[model samples]
Target: MRRFSQFTCIDWSGAKTERPNGIAVATINRDGPPKLISPEPRWSREDIRNWLFHAAKTEQDMLIGFDLSMSLPFHDIGCYFPQWEDSPSRAIDLWHLVDQSSNDDPHLNILSFLEHPQAARHFRHSRDHVGDLFTGGTGRLRVVEQYQRETGQANSASCFNLVGAAQVGKSSLTGMRMLHQLDGAIPIWPFDPIPETGPLIIEIYTTIAALAAGLPKGKSKIRDRVGLEAALQVLGAPSPGPLSQYDDHSTDALITAAWMKNASRDKRLWHPTKLTNEIAQKEGWTFGVF
Candidate 1:
């Protein structure tokens, strides 16, 4: 595996608004604490995509982690969408399908995809409105997510469930749109082989970062400088000092950036015991889940 000079983690959002307050970006390099990079109070999904393109051009080798599922579950059921002729077979194709289906949505929102006649059949839109094709029981789990569950790590919500505060369907779908737009400028790991040079993107679950930083399960969220500094110290990273805000999103990005700086050193993460070539190309593994 190639060494990365810098590490960045994005706490992404899929809110329908033009600029969702949930978006947060943080980065760290070889010798400093992670710092938040905010050009505005809130960021639109397109803003993050543009930032990444510019960073890929200017920054040193970087490992960027987005807190969203890179691809939906495909292996468990033999395909992403069972019995659906239009279901995509690979992660890249899935991204294209999502992007194309939601092209008319502004601010990179995934409303159109959620409402897509064929695509909508797979997602749970609301508490009272479950799609006819929606598979029951927490929807479906990607192979990586199943591994996470078996290992007693944090539990990831199904990319098909969009009904709760903890659900990640919206974020994952929106992220796919951004990934498609990126068009391989920054290679996404597992889906794309690690290049000898340049930045790489990977699916990340912020909870995994928090767990690696020594936080107990179910208590991964850090909301203050004290807690944040403690987690950073556990990861061998110095404190970023004071910040104007200490919300969960900022802290999640900050700690995850620091965690990636250390986690990337483990080559075994690049080849998990459960990940197969097929799973890598279709389901996509989370960076720190191994």
Candidate 2:
């Protein structure tokens, strides 16, 4: 397995604002515990994209994980949009389509894409306004998400369900735009070949990191210093000292960064048992799923 000098976890948001409180970033270097990085009071999607581009140039052999689905379920239905001929066939193309459709939206928001005539039919916009084509009780799940479910990990919100608090559709859409913008600056895993050096981006489920920290399923969100310290210690990462706040977003980023630091060393994760060439191209795998 390839070694990493640093690990980063970004808890992303897709709110339509200049700065979203849900966004949080944390990183761990070669020899210490992970610490939150807040260059500003709040971060926007564009801010993260710029920061990642800079990190890709400066950081050495880093693994960066984002808590959002990189692409929607394609293999489950044989295509992203069953009847739409214009639907993209690959993850990269999907990113391009999302970015292009939402190019005018501020702060990399994906409102335009959500409201697009064709795309709008695939997502569950609200409890009473579920799209006609939004299939399944909780929307479609990617192959990796199905694996997570079968293995007893915390259930991941489908990328097509934009309704409840657990919904990841908005975050995933906004994240796709960022991925499209960072196309050549940094290579995203599975979608792009793993570069021998420099940073690589991967889809991450924070709950998976929380599970690795010994937290039971469904109780993965750590929101207190005591809980945060206990989880960090379990990952063999030292204490980051007192934090200004202990919200789930901040704690999730911190714990996942530490988890990534240790988990990246496991060779099996780089090559999951079920990840195949087609899945890699259409629906990217989450780093810690396997």
TM-scores vs. true structure, each candidate: 0.97, 0.97
Instruction: Please give me the total number of clashing residue pairs in predicted model 2.
Output: 0
lDDT of 1 by residue, 1-290 (tens): 67888999999997889888899999999998899988855778888999889877875588999999999998887888876789889999999998998889898888887887888888899988898989988999998898888898769989999988899999899999999999988988888888888788998999989988989998889888899999999999999989998999999999999999888989888888888888899999998777
What is candidate 2's lDDT per residue for 1-290, written digit by digit as tens? 68888888999998878899999999999898899998756888888999888988785578999999999999987899877779999999999999999899989988988889888888889878877899959789999998989998658889999987898899999999999998779888888898888888988889989989999977888889999999999999998999998999999999999999888988888899999999999999999867
lDDT of 2: 0.89
Instruction: Compute the lDDT for candidate 1.
Output: 0.89
Q: What's the lDDT for residue 29 in model 1?
A: 94
Clashing pairs in 1: none
Candidate 1 TM-score, true structure as reference: 0.97
- Which residue pairs clash within candidate 2? none
Which segments of candidate 1 are over 4 A away from where they belong?
none
